[model samples]
Target: MRNSDPTLPPGAPPAAGAYTVPRTDPATPDGVGAVPGPSAAPDRVHAVASPPLVTHRECPAPHVLPGCAQSDGLSPASRYGELFVDVQHSGLFADSKTFPDCIPNCDPELIVTRYREQRATPGFSLADFVQAHFTRASVPESHYVSDPASTLHAHIESLWPVLTRKPMAHPPRSSLLPLPHRYVVPGGRFGELYYWDSYFTMLGLAGSGCGDLLLEMVQNFAYLLDTYGLVPNGTRNYYLSRSQPPVFILMVDLLEREQVARAIDFLPQLRREYAFWMDGAQGLRPGHAHRRAICLADGVVLNRYWDDRCCPREEAFLEDMQTAMYSGRPHHAVFRDLRAAAESGWDFSSRWLDTPAAAQPANLGTIRTTAMLPVDLNALLWHLETRLAELCDQAGDADAGDYRAAAQRRKEAIMQTMWDDAAGAFVDYDWCRGEPRRCLTAATVMPLFLGLAQPAQAQAVAQAIAARLLDQGGLATTELTSGQQWDHPNGWAPMQWLAVRGLARYGHDTLAREIAQRWLATVASLYTHECKLVEKYRIEPCGEHAKGGGGGEYPLQDGFGWTNAVASALMALYGDVAATCRVDVGDADSGGQPGHPLS
Candidate 1:
């Protein structure tokens, strides 16, 4: 994997351990009391403060949110519009997400009317106005602590209730789109149920004997499909304009394996989701794009991340606005790209940057998510197509053939456009640039994991995994550290699981086990002291110094649903949680060579 040169703005924390975790005790140092392995040390609490917020573009002084001025020609069409863009711009809450997530005490129109009434008055206070008109959002919190001696598996079991959200009887008007059944959130600042996150979280839920929640979560998504044209990025009104990576099919597959779900029952929902993604495919002309569907020059249809709305993300309004200001591009264009990246579930990664391998952290403004047809996303759609075929055939429907033909065309297109023989793996194709995005990410193994790759292709992908993507702790998200959560040194639960399952599918058991072992070790090492699971981990610098991964809008979060679930699932599949094989991970960096995953 190529190293990244981060070009972060002033006051932005570089990815140089910007997130600090306390070093554990010397006596029990290498502390893995919960699940012991080599260099299994616990980190003291993460103490590195988040970088100070900086609105990159200098707003005109005293203009009441200088970025909100109409002089820039950015007429954001948000219902909030210029009316209450002021609340976010005022920066009342430390986290920019706070204001958008707040439930209004009365109608939003009344709040706007009140704001207008009070705004021009001398000594008018935006903070006071907000306090009177809205209720602050409540971030989910857990005070439950695990016993120090409990195994990682047991701790995970105890955490299920903590992460689970019960159905609300009477919910307030907020960003959340309430579902009938209870579902799991990814935890921390992410308190809402995410579209793609539930699939990986289900792995742990199933292993910990919480399959009931898994079933309910799947049902909830189906319900969402029935209500909305497609499952939005998450269960939030703010997310209604976008959808995350379509993992709903995989979620149903997991339920089927448990012998509880029948794919035929979900045929309608499945078809609807596929239709949602392929909305503009049939009508698109060669070399044109619409929404999420991109048409190649060969007239082949593929998918790219996109959003229906072209405005700043409600949850990330301030940050998005700042990025647009810094981009030197039209605000609407940059806003669309930012939302599209969020829809990809890799909100910020070098993979979408103009110069992905730039020496310094590349400017956030360069992200062009809609320009690239991602290999993993297309592979997922292929699985969805094939699944639709199977279910349709099971129901004796004639459309099965249509789905099957679609699957074949998609697979062939993927191989022709995305497979880079020189890179020994599949890569994303930038349709706008007419080039390949060669950033080596753990996503390269998606085709193999889904059983969509030929033997030679799988072999080449496995070699690529061993040679570049692997690290001492586990597979890094990508080789570049661009101060993005989805970039280098950070290993996410979904990525690690995909690599492990994919490698093992191709009969590379040794490499699979090694990757799984290192990830489990890294997770369990922190579990000993923190007694908690985090959203992501620092896998590259794998030693006592290892801790939760950082770099993004939010701080490292605990009660992390996917991490807990993936950790438990890995323990069940690879080994007992109480016993992990010791791998010397601290000094095990390997240059691009076909070697051990944890070497």
Candidate 2:
């Protein structure tokens, strides 16, 4: 049925490349242990354009991946040194990722030597030197035809080639890590495969019947694991300091289900990613934390978002540096917290900040992401633990029991610590304060989505979602309107999928269907207007009132991967709402805007 007339037609035009649009994780099983390239099929790529002559970051991923393992071990600071500092501080580019992503005019070694020689000269200008040395990073321009009247489905299907970066044998000496096959980017400024974003993107890819491209993405992730030990935030050296979230296991699950294959082939890389997160867990003491793992006072071990470096993020250098300057806390501590927030994916939210009230705004400087153990993160890890047990059982591995026991232990820890009976919802545990943060957010739905919540817990969380989090269009990310993209009014595609799927899993079908329909209506209203997809939506309003999302490190990104994918996947699950949406969003009772649209 899917193949007969697939959304992405097989006979679609062989890509001469499409036109540009408007610009805008692995983890291990549950364990309390302390911390710590693709081996893929021979699907090779032809060398495309010759490697651009340029100065590159020190950790240049080799043409062949295995040789690049050492690159992951070194910090960008050590590799790029003062040269990295100058480019970021001198403000040569608006986006911090720009300079690092650019190809150089000559060899990196020569550039660095010349930088030292000329930096102190009377007429030396950091900006001029950078301009002379680095070529501007490649920006995708429009080549694909855009039919304004085309249905959103048609538009998304047409995007596959536009978003796909061609396969390459040799990569330019830029910050980008090389991949063995052609892969799709999320669109706009993001030009590489991401860690967790792939799962939801894969869902859309699956629904669209873009099977070959989807599998290529999974293999690319495996390649990252083999080459870099873990998938960095994105396929770039600068992002090596942190990862988005530990959803690599979920991605693997997608593969196994689609391919009807065993998980053993990827077991090594799976375990390796798990070990990376648990690297410092072995020796961690109660009431202590190490790397991404935390040991509560009661000896329950859980995870938190973290970054290895206690410095500014290369992609967010200016903003991170400004946040540190304003933060009353130590600069190092601020940088770490900022990076940790980035890892949480809700980069700036009341969930991570020291806010006065759930709905009140907070300054970015008040972020304390590393100090809290998120309920969604713990639930995700629990999913990993249980899945690992199942996979081990499938392969007849003896350690399945260890993983099963670990999952049970984590479930108990989550119920005892993360569940707040008074709040009637699961909340993040602020280990530092020894209490639940009690910030109501879409994250409460994760437990249900992953089947970690008991029936009673699911009921309570569902009630909370309906009473607080659900807005006019879909689920608001958090209760607060903190001038952050992830907060009130804006809803992200991934969060909507999590809520809709989780609610349905818990038998809250009415709420789930309403959410799905309303969200589709909102997206339809926009696509009808802008003819483009975006990273997030202003879902606190009705379909007609919905607007483009804002308030983040960058502008609203178009040609969005997850948004397009979630749209396709959701339509596949729930019948396509194109006709219904064109008529009306839903009945009035679905969701009428309240005074504040809080939560």
Candidate 3:
């Protein structure tokens, strides 16, 4: 039996103050070469020099160090030892300068001791370690770092708290679950594989412990933005002309929390992505006088989900009908008219779709011709503006302050413009038409979440929501009469979470718990039955078929990411009241003398 080769199986550890290397070949004779022989060893034997240090820059990919590859022909133990030695001497250690004369040959056990000590050192966070090692070679503009070792460490650190708490599991249900057919609709493949859905899913992935998946989703969205200047609703060619709601800002916010430096580095890209959403409004003239910036002549300022080019025959006919009916001209007469029918929070309304001759006279005037400004869209934009300003500030841009001020002004405007004094709810505004739409939709509650509503207004909106929108499981997107799956009857996980959060923000803890508990119970029931979370659920107790009955696009989607994320967040909230309080609305009293505040 021979002594293990330091570079073969049981490699010699780094000199003192290094990570320990484990032995792979314990079968080898431990003392074969312990004694010196007359011919085999000289009176003064010299130890072989350890492998040379590989600098971080030179190592290329430190996570997959050269020593680990079997192609290198080194035993596992020897490879690990060499890797440890390399890490120690490569100046990757927390305080390399302090251990300048540290030996390169020590026992594996001693190396482990040094590793532990370095980890315990203050100010040596795992994030710092990853930044030191991972090189962002793929996305130069995005500046994404890719040190797996560091990434893994950071992930464990961030996720440990949540994992240890272990939120409640989903409630049991039947194994057989019903699904809709539209989910698997043929030829419905849109561009880029459901772009909007993917964005929401990425949020869940980030919130959950799937960092790698989250990063991939981000990269995918970035690729879309880079390739097309915006992310389309789907990956398919037919969907290329139109994009979904502006969610890029939200995604950036999520990414920023995880890696602020990298997110800041991509500020320019974020700016560009924001431009895509506001492209239509960039140079538009005001529809109404005294309105700061008019998106419609009547007075509305809301945007619609749209694609400007490549209109399909079905869509072309619809546009032509709308144009002839409303303006008695082509739909392309102005940006506002084309967007009018779509401005309503009620997606795909029959009133908007019906030709002028066929439309009800009452619905025909300014509201039909004027684009409607949605409470949710404006609120989301306000937040986006605020976030963008913060990002700009972080990047040392001079315009950040101005951007923040503009956002605040916009927040005030949205509150003033959309709040309905008579309806007891925040209503959608047909800015061009000069009146409120007065319909109850989940979008109404957005002002509460944005903190744009006055306390009275928020409380009223919360009460209205509790009275009309809140169902057994969660808040419905809209009243049942709308007949739009995206609006009524269907309770989406993301929307439910938003409602729960919005209510909690307004100090409506009981209402928040009511929605949260019901939603969680539904999720658990579904999870128990299907063993996976779903995208949305039917709050009407009619089961999946009832919800699936009225649909246009595809059948209801399942295995959703946002749903899972919301579930996780709600579970976290339920388990810890202290955590919930962080998001709770403070002592802002509801305005006095209210049937409901908005009213």
List the candidate numbers ranked by TM-score, top first. 1, 2, 3
Compose the digit string of candidate 2's lDDT tens values, residues 214-262: 7788788777766656677887776765677788787777766777344
- The C-alpha TM-scores of every prediction are 0.84, 0.84, 0.55
TM-score of 2: 0.84
Superposed Cα deviation of residue 120, candidate 2 (Å): 3.7
| Clash tally, candidates in order | 10, 25, 25
User: Clash pairs of candidate 1?
Assistant: 5-359, 5-360, 5-361, 6-360, 6-361, 7-360, 7-361, 22-44, 31-41, 588-599
Best by TM-score: 1
Return the TM-score for candidate 3, rounded to 2 decimals: 0.55
CA lDDT of 350 in candidate 1?
84
Global lDDT for candidate 2? 0.70
Model 3 scores a C-alpha lDDT of: 0.45
In candidate 1, stretches whose alpha carbon ends up further than 4 angstroms from where it belongs are 1-8, 11-79, 140-143, 356-358, 542-545, 577-581, 584-599
lDDT of 1: 0.71
